[model samples]
Target: MADKSLNKTELVAKIAASTGQSQATVDAVLGGLFDALAESVGSGTKVSIPGWLSVERTSRAARTGRNPQTGATIQIPAGHSVKVSAGSKLKAAAK
Candidate 1:
């Protein structure tokens, strides 16, 4: 199976076409969505776009790991990472 792909321009065009809005408007709306996501993540808040996806933070406990190439033992400091989970509606739509 081949992977499907769509770029930002294609997405903007699709939104504009479907909403009968100007391309500029669609672009602005998309930009706002990205900005909101960034802000929410920065503030340590989960962002959920219903019928699309949810973005949240997950933590990793401190651990020891081996350096793959050098085979040297290293301590991996605990850290927080962002996780994105797809929503049920999106899963259904893709099927």
Candidate 2:
């Protein structure tokens, strides 16, 4: 399984084969899906697929950190982050 992960081209090919669609179409749909997710999350909205996954924006407080090389203190700025949670169906599939 370690070496069996699919890249974009391979994933698109498989989906296209299974759905009887062209590889270009599958890739296009995937591109659209990622765009939509980014747009929604960027706007502070939670995007959920009931049985698959959920994505949302989260905040982090600014804090102090050390420089890895210099061992000097530094300030880390607060920022927004994207969080993705796998839903029930995804969990069940993993099990």
Candidate 3:
């Protein structure tokens, strides 16, 4: 487990400080970035940042599942899901 986690506010503050921008501006930029990302990914388009991250939509097939409480079998419907991959730069930062 990590000792400390940075939330959205802290992240916006850090970015604002590093870029010499106001927190409000940084927050708006972040909001726009997320909105764009969601729009693109929701439309089945893959989003990639060369060395930082990639996100895409994936399809999950319908299948049988078990109900744990009743120990009964059930059918699970097909669904779409999002997959996020950390790119080389982000992976390197962890090392």
Q: Which candidate is the best by TM-score?
A: 3
Tens digits of per-residue lDDT for model 1, 1-95? 53988899999999899999999999998999999988888778999989889998778999999999999999999998999999989989879
For all candidates in order, the CA lDDT equals 0.92, 0.96, 0.98
The TM-score values for the models, in the order shown, are: 0.88, 0.92, 0.97
RMSD of each candidate?
Answer: 1.5, 1.4, 0.7
Candidate 2 overall Cα lDDT vs. reference?
Answer: 0.96
Best first by lDDT, ranked: 3, 2, 1
lDDT of 3 at 80: 100
**In model 2, how large is the Cα lDDT of residue 55?**
100
As a TM-score, model 3 comes out at 0.97
Which residue ranges in model 3 land beyond 4 Å of their true spot?
none
Clashes of each: 0, 0, 0
lDDT tens digits, residue span 7-89, model 2: 98999999999999999999999999999999999999999999999999999999999999999999999999989999999
Worst 10 residues of 2 by lDDT: 1-10
Candidate 1 stretches with Cα past 4 Å from truth are: none
